[model samples]
Target: MNRRTVVVGTLVVAGAVLAGGAYLYNANQAEQAVAIANENAAVLIRPNSPIIGPEDARVTIVEFLDPACEACRAFYPVVKSILEESPEDVRLVVRYAPFHDGSEEAVGILEAARAQGLYVPVMEAIFAAQPQWAAHGSPNMDLAWSAAEEVGLDVERARIDMRSPAMVALLNQDLADIEQLQIGQTPTFFINGQPLTEYNFERLDEQVHEALGN
Candidate 1:
């Protein structure tokens, strides 16, 4: 069986044998972990990172996401739902965590779509089509591109932009910070800089509400 069908390596699939218990195990042991040290807080958000929602939002969710990770795909709508309910109060800052095969290509498509102000639509499309392209052990990138195109992405333009130095550098920066922040998992979340203590929809929603003092 493909390891990523349930979970992808964050820290290897060995930890994933039991219904992604490793993620819960790690998150539960962090002693209510802060996502990053205050001194290193600046690393969490960079100007180049993709942002969704108002720039002046009161709460920021920094998510370390791998596009090819099934878990990330599963959580996308939940995150979106929270954002929709509180659009002006929360913003999502996406950080790259390309832990699966062909994820960079997927990220490249996303970054390029961002340039055209099509980030969310393209991303939704990509995630909707993820099963076709992100099938573990037998990935097919063409399906991803097709989905992006269906969302009105200018494929040719995206193709050129994906290889640009700026995109490459941005990706590299995100990866560097991932290591610096000790992020070892896909879909790892930090709300207002405090890492999520556990991987569950209820906890995730609670954290966001708590951040808003709701």
Candidate 2:
């Protein structure tokens, strides 16, 4: 199997393994866990988060995503589809969960890309070439930089900005949120301060609809 695939499978699949325990605990605990999780989710959507779609949309999908996770790359289009389908009603707020090695660096590049007004384009480029740079323990930073460069990002400027105090602080804050929210994996999502309570595309779609009161 491909190393990158293995890496993503390891993290996400392991997370799935824990879901059984979560379910067992939830059965014994009633809605208490979800209530606490919803409270935690409320603290996740920072104003400075990278957002797509209408800022004042009725529904918000806050995703704690890691740049190097293949699952995150896969769900990118699904989230985009949700946005495209309901441009007026929904927005996506991306929170960094840079769990994998080099994932933080990737996020740094994305923050730099955001500064240069290339956030969406660079995100597209990175996910498009995710397997190339996001390999298991050995991320190819060169390819990641090249992806940003391909999108007209000023690479040298980005490199400098990546290490800036603002960017460093941004990463730190998101990481802190991850810990506080008890997020154990990447690509975790909350819709309108409501945890999905289940993991699947159908569940995501349902949650979004529920948030919209539809």
**Considering every candidate listed, which one attains the maximal lDDT?**
1
RMSD of each: 6.5, 6.2
State the local distance difference test value for candidate 2: 0.80
| Predicted candidate 2 versus true structure: per-residue lDDT over 59-86, tens digit per residue | 9898999889876776676677678778
* Predicted candidate 1 versus true structure: per-residue lDDT over 1-214, tens digit per residue: 2222322323132333225532464643575356254546889899989999999999999899988988787777668877888899999999999988999999999999999999999999988899899988778999999999999999999999999999999999999998888778788888998888678656777789999998
Give candidate 1 regions above 4 Å deviation: 1-18, 25-28, 35-39
Candidate 1 C-alpha error for residue 184, in Å: 1.1
True-vs-predicted CA distance for residue 2, candidate 1, Å: 35
Q: Which pairs of residues have clashing backbones in candidate 2? A: none
- What is each predicted model's overall lDDT from 0 to 1? 0.83, 0.80
